[model samples]
Target chain A: MDRKELEAKIIELVAISYGKDEGEVTLETSFKNDLQGASVQMVALVSEIENELDAMIALQDASVCETVKDLVDAVEAEM
Target chain B: MNILDELFAKAKEDPQKVAFPEATNEKMMQAAYETGRDGYIVPVLVGDGPALKALAEERGYDPAVFTIVDVADEQYRDEVIAKYVALPDTRLKEKALARRMQDPLYYAMVMQKVGEADVTFAGIDNTTGDVLLAGQMIIGLKPGISTISSIGLCDIPGWNGSEGTLLAVGDSAVCTNPNAEQLASIAISACDTVHELLGWEPRCAMVCYSTLGSGAGELIDKVTEALKIANELRPDLAIDGEFQLDAAIVPAVAAKKVKRESKVAGRANVVIWPDLNVGNVAVKLIQQFGHADAYGPMLQGFNSIVCDCSRGAPVSEIKGNVVISAVRAAGQKK
Candidate 1:
């Protein structure tokens, strides 16, 4: 999946992932600080990313990640 | 011909160390009395000694052929309950108080708990709730187990059309709305149980509407979580899910639909259902409507003792439950 498509899919998962109202999450929105996504949600996101794009990003590496852009970059590198 | 015969054979080869519950009913009595050729002669724990003697006499059960423990006397009752509550593994007072509110089934569980018997089978006339309550109150679930269930061995006649396969379906009678994590735990536990009962290292499938993430919903989410956790728990276990039945069991369909290269797909011998309601209905339909013979939905994850039985089950079925429980106890000890 391309970056734009990938970003959109990530948002969809994030909204459900955080149980937030759709369209509320933005690219710069901090997953932990602003969205309240738990550790389980991050793991789930990593799995979803792997399945969707057939790539793996170290969940440990992702744990230190703070923004949606960080995830996109991780996905890009893994892709 | 079945694993049951093999297990009974094993039990007979070691009869004194062989501790099996006494046949409380005529059918079980007949099975136990007539159960020869299998190595072990099991000990029977009957509620009423005189009643059992009367029935044995009526049924022509050689009073010499079996050893029976009459648990009806008050002293015996207190002794049994005290022993059950005293076990390092059992929480005695809580269980005693809980079971004191009930009758015979609770008493029966205490007998098993105190090592008066190796495996205890009750509930021929009792409800699932009754059997389970006795187990939970007296025997309690194994240390980490948060729930209980029934996993039946269903042999669908014929293979490729004539030699049918045997499958294990679980939580058919227990665990409602199991979360993603619980579902994963159930799958792993069921796989172990399948190995113990059927003598096969089972391929597990977490059944869902979706095939390879094609279907989406809360149910899919649960199955997906189970898949991830199963990988983590038993990395070597062959398991997969979030698939339709066709893809889960049929090789051709699975090859076309399921994306993961999983050993479990199209070859799974164990099926984990989403909820007890669905599982109970599915297994029942397969047994009653499809003419498949089922043997459990046995309790798992309990501590030292196990208590389980069918609702108004025949004697043969109850005997099988005992054998399975004994085998499980033996398996856990290892």
Candidate 2:
């Protein structure tokens, strides 16, 4: 998928991970600022992305990803 | 001194308040009562205060010595819940936190989180999942901990290894199938656990079927990666591996098989399994055939000490774990 499509899918997964609405998540949503960088949510988000999108995102790579766009970038690179 | 005696002495040196949420279970209540009576910890039993006291009296325990409280007690419940919610870094959101606080397990967890209690001990009547979930939501994870895992001790009957008949194994009862990062976290946590509980400078070896790149597979790859990550994350720690069990602990095997200047190859006191499958089986083998006494499967990587006793465990075993956890809590206190 392209960048826009990948980002949209990641937003949905992030929303589910943080227990928020789909519209509430955005590309600029910072993990540290907004989500407190919870490792549990990061795990849920990565596993969901891998299962639903067939993209294997290593936690080490995703761990440094500060924003929704950063995570999307990591996933897309793997794809 | 033996490990148990040492732990008991250390625990009594500075007893922490351990909250038992399963107060209604006779085994749990009796164990808590006896533990408190012996002064290894200050026991806080959570449930209906009157019913807990009555049950303790019926069971021939001194109810006055134990502090019993109820999550449904509006004044105390509101106090702990409000304190926990006001903490700087809470894991759960507001609505979910409120809903979970209704359970005694979560309430006790919040008690520990807010510093009202030192350790939260349960899981006699609750599932391990329930206990872990409550811990994650209330107590939160230690900084840099990717996931919650467990560590245990095996006191083998008639043998002496580098650590003198005792070996620490981890993640046997939790984290079913861990990725490389999760595996590394388990090793790091186990290192900290053995250090705190047994006061040993941990020589943690990540044990798998492969010995220093001798084998190749996804499983072996995971262990090798975990070793690298663990070393990277905590370079000060003695974490090494991609060794077979024999190579990890046995000097002779390690000398022949491992061809590197590895710190944790032969004289390793702690062994971290790749996943729960290997960990669970390894513990059973040690217990049944090796005739070793297993001390834990004690949960680690949380901000505070947490444990989930086997539902089938007898009161004696539970009391031992309580002492063990209390000692760890005491040592881990910063």
Model 2, range B130-162, lDDT digits (tens) per residue? Answer: 787677767878888889999889899886788
In model 1, the runs with Cα more than 4 Å from the true position are A1-79, B2-24, B36-41, B72-83, B94-104, B160-164, B228-237, B284-291, B304-307
Residue B145 lDDT in model 2?
84
Off by over 4 Å in 2: A1-13, A16-39, A42-79, B93-96
Q: Evaluate model 2: give its lDDT.
A: 0.85
Q: What is the TM-score of each predicted model, taking all chains together?
A: 0.67, 0.82
lDDT by residue for model 1 (B49-159), tens: 677778888887677766666655766666666665567744335333333423545555666666666555655555655565556656665443445555667766542
Model 2's DockQ score: 0.09
- Model 1 TM-score? 0.67
Q: If you score just chain A, what TM-score does every candidate get?
A: 0.83, 0.92
Interface RMSD for all numbered candidates: 19.4, 8.9
